[model samples]
Target: MKKKVLFYLGILIAWFPAFSQTDNSVSAITEAREQLVRKNHEKSYVSHILTGKRYDLKYRGAVNSQFFRDIYPSYGTLVYDGVFFDHIEIQLDIYQEKVVVLLESKNNEQFVTIDNEKVSELTFNNYKFVHIRHDSIMSDGLYQHAFQGKHSDTFIKRTKLKKDKIENTKMIIEFVPLDKYYIKNDWGTFAITNKKSFLKAFQNSEAVVSIVKKNKTKFSKKKIENGLLKAVSLLDPLLIDN
Candidate 1:
């Protein structure tokens, strides 16, 4: 059965010719794009879709968010094994590191999970995330692209966890957010949690710390994002020779 599906997908994927502005060429390209979309749909669904087991929501828990942005499946795009697919219903499970999708078969519907290792890029919530693996400085995981500079780039690792606590004389599980920020340069990737850590990433820590204070940049967890972006822009020129 799997072989049959793979063979079916192979025949549908075809090469495109060089595009021209003529009316006939434009029409041909449109048809080809439509075909490509259809092929992508079939290839993505038929080959990689998995009937993933979902956690029971009946457990006593007051959850805030267990997903990337929305608790429900959001329309997005993903690059799976070098194939680009758009208009896919997906949810990024921050806790379990899973990608769940809603798949409909006839009159029935199910939330299915896809292989995460095959997925390199995912877009939703007006943001882009890339799966980083086999890197020298960074750990293997999904990281959200925050800012890019000539000397360095920044990424965010998003996560959540369920904590058991007592509230109103009842035991309840609450979801908590835990996010980590990283800065990667030619040397290595460093986790910058606060001003101290941010300054530590540079060779001249004392000078960098003074410059950061002079510019009044707060780089703690509360204001890490904007702070890091501003710091990168401020320091990129100084490290241009490095």
Candidate 2:
């Protein structure tokens, strides 16, 4: 009886640590999922940038009926022609109710139009900006600018990773060029050389995990401004042209 009692006690002690670890892992995964959902909601705001703009913009949400029917017909090729602007073709991918903006370029012999079949090949070239949660455990800029704007350039591009969960998860935000000159001149080149910016942005933008938990559901203008500034500052070294 004494030996059996000791053996059971040892098993209980071993199982306790395993149970605790499993609980911790589950909590971490749950928190990560919540952070991701918040990030997705925050990204929805990017659409506001195109609210009244004449540029062609598309939206795909997580609905199947009308959304799928509406997007499927345009799957082959989409051409946009504005009186003051040259023609442009946008290749789109509609899956899981998320629309990835594939490519945009001038309709010319030098540029190649994207086809629906080639979307997977072109997705890597596409850029997206998102807001993310971060933990305050470390200090570094969370964003970077790949291209420096010219003197007269009206817009600039920046990319950043907002850290969340002690660097375990990150929200990658890519500032898109709203201005025509910046879009045409700087976008392509920066996309190629600015890979480091992505890493650095994640490093710089650490915040308190508790703060993120408190503010996850609420959107604050101040937080967005601060994050944007930090991201742009990381790009200072690359901003020589501006």
* Candidate of highest TM-score: 1
lDDT of 1 by residue, 52-108 (tens): 555443433366756777776788888876778788788887877887766667898
Looking at candidate 1, the ten consecutive residues that score lowest on lDDT are: 12-21
Off by over 4 Å in 1: 1-61, 105-107, 205-211, 237-242
Using lDDT as the measure, the top candidate is 1
Q: Can you write out model 2's per-residue Cα lDDT over 20-124, one digit (the tens) per residue? A: 568786575556556655666566543221111132332233222222223332223221221111122222222221223333336622222222222221111
lDDT of each: 0.75, 0.30
**Cand. 2 TM to true fold:** 0.18
Model 2 stretches astray by more than 4 angstroms: 1-85, 89-91, 94-230, 233-242
Q: What lDDT score is found at residue 158 in candidate 2? A: 31
Using all chains and alpha carbons, the TM-scores for the candidates as numbered come to: 0.69, 0.18
